[model samples]
Target: MRHPHTRTTRRRVLGALTAGLLCAAGLATAAPAAPAQARAGVPGLADGLALTPPMGFNNWNSTHCRADFNESMVKGIADLFVAKGLKDAGYQYVNLDDCWALPQRDADGKLVPDPARFPHGIKAVADYVHAKGLRLGIYTSAGTRTCNSAGFPGALGHEYGDAQQFADWGVDYLKYDNCNNQGVDAKQRYTTMRDALRAASRTTGRPIVYSICEWGENKPWEWASGVGHLWRTTGDISDNWGSMLSILKQNLPLAPYAGPGHWNDPDMLEVGNGGMTDTEYRSHFSLWSVMAAPLLIGTDLRKASPATFDILDNKEVIAVDQDPLGRQGTVVSSAGGRWVIAKEMTDGSRAVALFNESGTAQRIATTAAAVGLSDAPAYTLRDLWQHRGYNTAGTIAATVPAHGTVLLRVSADPHWAANPPAAELGLDASPLLEAATPATLTSTVTDLGRTSARRVSVSLTGPDGWTVQPASATTAATLATGRTLRTAWKVTAPPGTPTGAYALTLRADYRSPAGERVTSALPLTASVVVRPPAGTSYLSGLTWLSATSGWGPVERDTSNGESAAGDGHPITIGGTVYARGLGAHAPSDVSFYTGKACTKVTADVGVDDEKGPKGTVAFEIRADGTKVASTGVLTNAMPAQPLTADITGAQVVDLVVTDAGDGNDSDHADWANASVSCGGAAPAVRGD
Candidate 1:
């Protein structure tokens, strides 16, 4: 959230100009009178709904329009919400995204639930959810048909009847989408539904939380608060780091428009999706929470891992999101892929997030005074992830891993000394390891509290069947405040371990001055990687360690379209098609492990013709984080440009695509016939 003191001047100028422009464009209008208790000057429903951003489960991201998304699935989700403790964790809504209704309406012009999908009807599903102490949300479009190609009947011209039907069915939330609107004005269309919902709430005594899904094409943040409880500030989010980061950038700048009952929805949570790493998912959750966005779970709970639940069930972080102050976190400092965001809390604390967006670890730091907190001789710094409190002399700092966030709650408390003595831990070692190779891992512990600690001990543990031996002394006695201890461990991955990420835990235990035993455990991920083949190979057939795209999933040998995997045509550039290549959108990065054996990489790079003369993108090839080759800005009108890079002695290679100054719209980029030659071998020639 933007600190009111620091942003007052900028907010006044931007707010006035924005309001004036919106009113002149006829997109802004006088909002209905809010209830007496509603926050003054904020536009939203008077029904006291969505006091905090709604936490819930939505089926669209996990099982969109699938056959399994039926009555059983909906009821199962409600069951999980209770059985898995999500109910206690504050997740209340079980939403059906789309394809839950029939293609046509009944003779009375009322929407009908699909008998095939909802056997006992929508009311039964809502009742099942309500029985579990949760609310039910349903999806619809403001046009003649829903967004899905199934062409489900929408509530555009039948807003009153649809809203009434939803109320009668016990629907507690409605996600109104944009599709096939026939050129209707966005504000006029959404306002009609808002009025209808209000009337239904009066008659049925069931208020529904409204969600506006216009894809931010009309700058919904400027006019949506009066019409919806939360509004999407960007396009639909794909389960990738690039998509999440792009959406975060779009939503973070609109902080002033979100508060109390109204929020800036950057789409739903993609925490458990398989596309991104757990570290990235944690960042996704942390950033969303700090920004005060909705915490809608977008994964199947039944199939989620313990790690996924750990990220979702973080109540300390959730408290920051549900903070009654309702302030969205704003960037206090951002540069070179490092960002420091701060949110003012109601209890005179500030939630600070040190985020590392780059591809390497970075030390991000900020002062408490910089985050709108009053200065003091000492302050309390609570690590939300670690669930520990420490004393700091106003400085909040952390070495955040790539695509990770360090979330801390800082407060100038007079009783700071009453908290337990805290120690900060750090691990200085590469997280990647080859099987059966012994690597030395160093762990550092620093006393950051107000008092000294005794009997400090540190240990490193790996997965079962792996060897972990101490390389240095792991115990210390009588460590004073501000003291540091370093320990080393020789760890070896077992032979034949799978080439994937595994967990390692570094733990520290100490006796506080108050005789309380304090323990801190930090989890690290170790990835076992296998080098590429010795001969030349097409990158499309190789396994990328990680890949992220701006719009959708990265496609192999196809154009990067606006959908998930395999939803694109053959890779095409300037009307020319290629059979072997990578298709990715701008703001994309695909990394492969070469193990320092690859000699060179060659490709024909350009903006794919699928965008049809609209995209502007630049292609880059990086070897071990250093740029080895690049292309000037290329557009869809340009032919494929041949490029080659010397990747000798580079362990990893990255294929990158970036938007050229302009936005990322239609930036479908391709690396046609991309291949890497390894071990000084001759390049493999392919006929296309």
Candidate 2:
């Protein structure tokens, strides 16, 4: 059972829905016994259903229940699923998400369909689906409520009864969800339902596909095999590239756990969701197909245009999902945000997807040598989406679009064929980082693509005063590109080392992958402030700036630091600066830290300082020009005063201090020596 805090909340809700139905149908009415043994020749639920890619239509991305759902929508989609050849293409299930069930269970302890929309009853809906030569899929949860706490009588204590009811309704597929089940033991909670589903299937003699949906909690791969067929390995996916990539990257390391009977479900596809451009959607489909994920479409099938229809109907791409090899792709290489390599099936051929995750377009080419196929057979290539043939002499090459991918099917050209030996060089890290002082340096070794290096040496550097530990010189072995080696270093900053700015550097060695050792570095970062937890405002600002996403960090130790770090003091009229990202040059508003009860004072501070990506250095002051506060040079430091500013009962306050080059009073002009604060009902500066 997935709690709301799990990575992907919505998918867990679906998992709960599936499990709850089985329990409702009467399995495990009492406490569980030991794990049951399988009867000879009895197929696992996953084996009987969902043996291939799970074909279904979900209501998240394309619909989201923003509008009133009706039988027309359901029947229309069922008609489209068949009319559009999707059912023939192997898509056979239709599942609804939240908002379909009523707020209360009926007298029979059975969840009643909504009277307004599901007037015909859920069983009637199931019959409608079955009449179309398709299967009916319904949603529910392990908890007593749904995602929004709407009532939908769940399987919390009545697993057996609920499972029996769903079985009686002729429900062919169940999407168990996870929601509102917090404060309960997740594993035991889900396990109880899994056992119930097993018992329900045995008693009813009906096969129900078990979907474990805890948003990958308790590491689904660790226990999902015995519980469900397909486990949601990540949060619900949105109709954007980042959402897709984030989910995909999370599933890479869990590849070994996926097999023919089980899979790493990376949520559903947003192919025709209208949130992304067509090119991005094509890339999205290619990536998911190459990953061998469940191909559940979250689009309004009835409205799918020819383009959408064509992409979904691409048999070549679909072949990758139904590959006989039954192997899920794993990420072979990653450079954080730059590139990735994933492998899958190519209809008896091999499909490799080389992706460039950068902002600008990147040309990525790999010889059979780099990816371990040095002397493989001559090959024919075809771009899956383009449906065009590609002829390669020896090397396969393509320019991946920005935030895009190139899917290639590799097989013998028949003109030339040969077997090649696999290349050998590996990389691994052990306890990658350990305890160190505030400014200690650490190192990790790398293996080169080549075997040896004539002058193999490594360097450790990051932030200010990074020192190589003990001895810095060693006659090291030639490090392969993916090989691992350790380096030790210490970071020592002199008293004069600035306290505000931090540094990040890369440790590089003069070692090349193929054999020629060259000095290339890996990047590292060192910071002065406490690390902010992810998603906090401070971290969001910093991460955005570091990515050069139009934001820059301020120089805390400089004159312009006042605005970035200042506490509210003497009344200022116009504006006060806090942090500057974009909109600095553009007209903007400022916030002030006013003490608890500071009364009113009318004034405006003319914040005229503007600088680099960090923005301008200026300040805001009271109209009378008596009180002055300044936004100093760009820096990353928090002000000595509280962030909020207050101005009450004060007639005059001057907040602007001229930049050093502005010819203002030198005493206030130099930010390095300026330490301004207010007393009493004033905002006080604790540090200079």
Candidate 3:
């Protein structure tokens, strides 16, 4: 693990020559780009070596420095590539990563393959690969020793000789590393080998794809196009998610520098390595394809699973990488750990991927306009994995599973035979949280895509401390293109939690349009708001109007409680009618009128909490719901403010409150001891 098989050298010649190199690229764009052959006038080397980012198998991921890199191992993989139909699918080269050469060069100063490892010699291995219609690839370091230094003399001082030997051996690719170079100038050192490769090609007429394996320290994308066919953009890539994500970040920014002949390599593909889940590997392949990175397989091909083959041999997905345009995709939008990467394919259409890196599934969306084609004419869309095709006006959306991707190919053409059958789930689900009501999130799903989804079921989840229970997802026997389903979930916030939006996730699992045999999940979050309700306690305020009719909230009147309206301070009230949480807001209405009256109706009201109202709580006793006995406005908060209304002939009353002149500012009008007596009877109204 010293340097992930290769170390990056500094940027001396590379940085200095970056500007000129970029300029030359601009001129090349005028000519038709030959993906198989485009050389920017670099001397010696021929045009078109690593056209389309060299596809083949490598031995690093499955077999490390266990001396398992013998000729037999490589030969097995090369044969499997053909047997598995990978050759027809465009996999051409079979590469050996490191420790493949003998301890020292022969006395004639030529590199040698290990006698026991390659009994017939490296040339014979090359012949074996070539006979199978596959190219042969070999590895070495620029330093005095390889990463493992398993005895082979490094190519530090023998660049020309090593390149010539590889050419003579019929090697189709050379992965030149930078192991123990003692901090040499990366551009200068790589430039030396570039010239050597050119010289070797002239002398032998064999074109070897020169891979600049100096890692990414020199920013190879800025200058490597002039020297090699491909250059490593990141150190090493692991099979896990975190490692892969970091490596992808390094490669993404260098997309513009990648073209037909030169590519930005983010290490090799770790597919079929058994290190990650199937969903993760799918995401890996999708990302690499969009980036247009090298598809060098780093796995034990002999034992690859059926799923692995399906992922690797995905032709439609592969076409995105091998597009004649050779442009790498970039993130169009990223939110909630979901990313939408878009690349324009050679066909004037686009290839987009909805990638979810979050631990849970996520609903990711992107319009045709977002990917630069909203205004284009009618187009055909294909889901690469599901192999389903359909027509679209232009927008594409999908609910991606965790660590998964929804790969799409958008073509500008309106006609096509059945390209692929793909099914997508569009679930509109979210939460509406209020302090006054129990929280519930509802998710309604509709499948309008081409394919029919099977056995759709859903589940709900939330963050820590909060409780959430989602109704079981309705099992749909066949969710055809026009079918719809819905599910609901209730959320409960733990006591003492502040008021704000919390993510409540709804996950749906179902079979794709393919079948009910395999399952996929879609996740989306509903922001559940948790805060105490505002305004008067239902018990304190008599029967009132609806929420829209100025019926404010009723919350606990505690210290720091939101008893005031529009986010104000708490209020204090001394009354048995209201509970721990009480809210009294002005601009409110209540009625207590019935025609049977008492002597006088009296009540003592104070500011609900300290954040008292600026208005007065006036009582109007009426004979028929009309105002008779008036208390006017009691705006005093000192001592005792008693409001008495003479019942005389009034059998009913109307209690209306309003903020003085300041709209509803400080409208925390608490009407304590509020009553409407009839014949020495209690106020005929009570609130909960």
Candidate 4:
């Protein structure tokens, strides 16, 4: 066959012979973003490792070790996954979280399956998973002890050997946790297991997907890409709306790190959990799809109701997940609890999601033209959950439910020939009613299979008394103007922009060199809030910064009841201090609720002046502990400087600051500012 590049090669040779001409033409330039290539599927797994997002049953949040982990229960769920076509939909991995391991290892330094729950042994169970065409996943900690207090006989000094055993047992996915990899960097600890998995894979001749369960310690995004397929980006998500929303909010900053080869894990799904309503669960699924997160179901597949299955099986909704684009959408604009986001799909289509996250329903209106399309292309508009299709003019006026979402897949309208346009321009899902930036008015013109436009001109009538800046422009007739050339300008925070919602007339004129003129006018609107209205605080009282999960620093303080005992109650830490909720329990047997960031921590020890050790308090931070902050001291006088320390990726450190005194009135101590810096932390793994 003739080589197609021969002529191009000859041209290149001639260009080499005529370098000046080639330079003058400027035809050569670096390729844009490396010619979009097909992404290789996940490593050491089938090509469809993540076809539609991993979905299956989990032990925690559902079974929760509540006596439902028997072999029959596992097989029953497996049967349901198959019967529900979940496996056919690409939900293959059946994962187990903490609390499944036995309390002790055998005499040979090997993990022993709990005989009471698994008489056939874990290997036999894994065989059952493979037999059912589903892969098996298991969880374990890098520490000597598991999160649920089960001691690992081989975990203390046998991480690699243990990984080999998991591979030997035919485990396909391993959620390696950071329970007690003390004195080691979190990245290092995870890396240790990664290497172990590789070695084990070599020995067992079976590929395993290494899942780093560091609980968002360090900043997983920073190093997660090269280390694991997926990393948890937030603490465990609960079945409540607050938990789901909080995890979503926490993942916003980690978007840049998500891609085809890697994902951001917002923990597991709580679709069938009891804390939230069906609407909230739908919202959860909607947001997760938008965020491109892994869809690991933490509910019992066998017991989920019809509503749960409906939410999970909506193909329209799942399309967002399976979209080859693999790009997570971002909130382009937000106002008054309303949000507009844009997501790019693999098929070159964009999904615009308009949502009302407030307490009541809101009217979401937009023009296809405003969303940057004119003579609007054909669109297949459907409510993802409702599965109803509505074909209409360029404008869309949908009454969006409160805390609900409207996802629209907008593309070139193809049925224009069949349906004559009554208007010159149309709007798609563009939230023109809530424009947020000066760039909102920007629009991209389509040539419509014809020559491109030379110049495009647009104009807007001043709103009421408002004035237009740099108001007018002249352009070549390339744009068919009458609204066909989606043209609009975003409202700016103009010096005198109004303080309330307002609408104005927008006009566009496309003139050809031959003197042909096309003009059109439509209503353009926007909201201008000089300052955001104030309301009751969403989060109340003292908010302590949480320590990073896995390993990091712990800010020390000696104020607010620092004693030998550790109480989980909130205490005032001087200076600005924070603490993350480390998985480790407080000495007082209570769980700490730090608000995701802090260096200093305090305990709630009320005034006990009569006690001999009135001012006595003690706090500790260890390498094995998840939160890491510098040691802080509290005194009656003199300024205190922050303690200097280095927290390499994933290393655990103990932080302790205390105030103690013998029986005496002079025994007084004040503590504050207990927090940890995430600079040296592991990258969070996000599954979008």
Candidate 5:
């Protein structure tokens, strides 16, 4: 992803960011930035294009470079945008991604639209889109050839020429792709196009929104603010539950790099696509809205049903994306499949998502204090999707269907907290923690209050003689309510820290939002028990799972329904106990005996119960980062699939249960009699 902002543009952005903090809070909204008159206020710079995440219709997802997406199709989508109420909802750009050009450049080395497809050419298409009160977008590449594989040559050596040609054709947006660039530096090649576009704009007085699509490998967010309006944060997204969720996991941490004028693009919206269920689609839209992602439409407008329009044209949710504050929502709390992601809205309120990633209906609840809904005896909550309102001042509770979301806009009076702040601490130990080796200890400090908690600090207390790092840790900033701060400490017990089950006193010190000093204490007990020497343990117990408690409660099953409503009966081998979601995303982990290499891992796995949720799951085993083995798309009624993987020379083995094509709701996946064998590198279970 190329487009680097100019020096002056960066200065203005940084200067304006000084007030961004206020925008991020519910205190105020940032004014929309004014575009620079000249590129860089100097000469040639691709200044203002998208003051917000550019939204519009893109034909690639719905048509995928097929022969059908032509001038008529593009014009039809534009008409639908107006007819279906998409135009007034802030979705204006009509972008053409890949395969839009002739296979070869003209004899004069100029690019041209395919005659067979557009008969009248791209200029006519742009005119049609402009006539409909909408803007038209075109596509190109940074390399010698485009990503279409058999598409036209890129703008590589013809940046200026292509720029001039596009200007002549009256293109309003450019989707610059990355493919076949003969080893040219990504930044250099992209910057070349930026200048090309700037020259065209200055000469023609028409601005084009440049989208950098380098696919996140170039760390575009690190240097891609002013260069373009938005940059893809990851690889292209597939139309499936796993692809959507996977991209989200990678894009969530890039939130800080997104704001007004520039954004972290997680690719286009796939709302009406048939890959995921309605519930999953809601989560997709809800996440993109709160995360400040570009709200581009990637579905066929003509075929989109009313339900699809309901999701795409939700004005209330759209307002959050178009909020002048331009702040992305962050994950405040996540446990099991229940997640709380919150965004501070402009009107001293908040837009929140209570998401259930499980396969069954779950009780999603959170207190007003958790989201900084302080100083109010009561607050009004508006359901964004259902278009209804509720009054609540305590815990906001709802039963979200499997893979469903309960999205709400809370109007809370922002003020100092009137009640004492509550604190929660979670302790996690290293999977390889042994008797003599130093292990990293992680602890989280959460302020269960309705306002910001100030001067927050936490410490862990164990036996007096234990070896612990940084006896205490202080947060660099005040803790926002519902926000959890994780601090890690290196701890070691020399067989003298009073072994066995021990309670760690995790105490916190903080001041109330009103500046009143307060102190809180919470205890986390982890067995200081000795992990048996190297080769003596199997992953037969919950203690072996790396993050057992991070999710909702997971139960070991003897019979399928023992944990939840599933039909999985433990395979009669190895051990009667099998691990499944029990209505949760049951992710488990185990380490090989440090003394030897794991030769192989074996398991009999099947989808938990198809009779009820019929949800799907994939069982994956990875040693280090190498995927050693996996059972793809496990479903109910399918015989237990036998799997094996060579984890040779690996010290850790991880079993990850992921949501199948559907959401994780009722995805009761079972790994019966799962175990790994140690051999080779060490004393191969000596045949004494």
Candidate 6:
């Protein structure tokens, strides 16, 4: 279940004409269908649902019953499933989360779709989805009420009736929640719903995919395979790297319980939520797919960016998740933030992932024999992200970026020439740049395949207004195996460009031995920033080049309380209140361009008082990636502790807050009266 603090505000308008309207729409007056033959129970569902992990969209993470989650929005999602090629990509179900219902059930104990939200009721929505060749999924809790604060009725005691109603209404999937469960036995409650669904499926001849969302509270993996098609193995996932990584760690150990028709779900996909970078999002998608977890998208598809769609529409990666083998990838090695995971495929191949969970790039390596693949003289390595193929003598390795993953498919095949030759591309340049300043960037393309690449060419392109000029030869007549082509370009950000990260593309085009054209591209980020004026100032007054948090936006001159901006009170720690500072949640980083002018940074740091005596956090100040100051662990009971760091000659200064060993619950940290000392005269700083 999602944390109560993050629940969206519920609409309390009760539809007085719900029953009458439903009857008028013929949704309530329809006669029940005859029951079909009964199916066997236990071990797993005999109906053979969810043969592959369910792929679709669920509205809870993005909308959460907000006003936009209405009939039109749900219908629009179904339309996108067709127009955006998602339906063809194997996405089947269009699920609605909580807040789609009224505050209470109708007169006859029937669930009422909030008339304002679903004026035509759920059946109409299901019909529209089914018309688009897609399935429909609905949510309800096992307890008396749903997870939302609105306290909408659940299907606990009315399991059979509710299941029957869903079947009659054309619901093809059910996300059974665990909240408000009233201390009932986990297995018993889930099993009851499973039985009810089976009975309903027989009557309606419609098999509804059952998703057990118990949040891993009762070790559902140990018993849920026989009860539901899929079971959530973790709590609600927040749209941050820390939260995502934590959940991934929790789900990776339960691989043995998942198989075809039954899966261990690690919650929904947060790839397009905007809290994390595109690199991190790609890592999220890659990790989930390799683990064979359900790929229920949790973002508003209508407003998603092209990059989001690219990550979601990667057919190669999706194939790994939907692989008929149904083997969840297992961790082959993990140490010092480097990890190697391998999943065995049905065709005697292996899908391997080189993941970097640390703060820097690390080269992760493994062999085919190590990942359960038979030893061969040479194995074809398919880079899932690059969409290219390479041949190696059983050695598979790549330098993965921080919070990134390199996914590859390894297979020993005699017909390897049918695929494109493998080429690796890289970009070397400072990610941070000043407006209008020309920077030199180098791109290197390496031929890692067994055959040589012919007529290889490389080019760099930036945003529309930016300039990119070749500084060295960008073409090569021939590149032999194990050889690299290095090219340089002078790139300049246009004057007056906004101070934020802009995408740059480094592309390589070459011809394989069989005369097939191959293209490999790498995305790079360049942040244009303004340097601080030559003076002392409070850090909060300056615009941050980048800001990320675990729960919400980083607050200025306040405490991190909730997900909304400016929702925090004053920055209070212990018995003191500081009016000027930063209120950041644990697992946060805020960076500013200092331009080597700032000499030192000072602050009084501690866990914020708003969190009471609950949180434990540590603070660190980094100048140009070198730690200059640190605070060990400070709890809410501790007073403000003064600290200072010399940041002389540093181009960037970073304020980082991390959860101290324990989980990041209520870990709101404050940098009290944080100030930067720069050369020259003092300047006025902004404050609330």
Q: Against the true structure, whose TM-score is highest?
A: 1
RMSD of 1: 8.0
Candidate number that wins on lDDT, 3 or 6 = 6
List model 1 lDDT by residue over 55-92, tens digit each. Answer: 99999889988898999998998998898888898999
lDDT of all the models against the reference? Answer: 0.83, 0.52, 0.64, 0.51, 0.66, 0.82
**How many residue pairs clash in all the candidates, one count each?**
3, 96, 33, 90, 8, 2
The global Cα lDDT (0 to 1) of model 3 is 0.64
Q: Write the per-residue lDDT of candidate 6 for residues 86-194, one digit (tens) a residue.
A: 8888899999988888887788878888999999999999999999999999999876668786778877777888999999999999999976665668887888888
TM-score of 6: 0.79
Per-residue lDDT of model 4, residues 1-688, tens digit only: 0011221233234335544432353322222121112122223223334433455566677876667776676777778778887877667787766656677767776787777777787788889988999888888875555555333432535666688888998988878765544435777567666666767776788777767666676777778666677788765565655446556667756777776646777777789776666766887888787777777777887778998888777767777866776777776666644666666777655566777554334555565555544465444344566454433355543445545677776555564333222222323222222223453443322222121223456555546544444322323346421334554444454555544446555554443333444354544333443211122111112222122111112222222222222432332223322332211111111112222222232322222222222233333443323434433333323232344333333222333332321111122222223233432233431111
Candidate 2 structure quality by residue, lDDT tens digits, 453-520: 33455555444344435345433655433444554455554444432334434434453333433444
Query: Which residue pairs clash in candidate 5?
Result: 3-227, 336-551, 336-552, 358-665, 359-665, 359-666, 369-449, 369-450
Question: In model 6, which range of ten residues has the least summed lDDT?
Answer: 8-17
Which 10-residue window of candidate 2 scores lowest in summed lDDT? 544-553
Q: How many clashing residue pairs are found in candidate 3?
A: 33
For every model shown, what is its TM-score relative to the native structure?
0.80, 0.58, 0.62, 0.55, 0.59, 0.79
Q: Which whole-number lDDT from 0 to 100 does residue 212 have in model 4?
A: 69
Candidate closest to the true structure, highest lDDT: 1
Q: After best superposition, candidate 4 residue 676: deviation in angstroms?
A: 38
Question: Which is the better candidate, 4 or 6, if ranked by TM-score?
Answer: 6
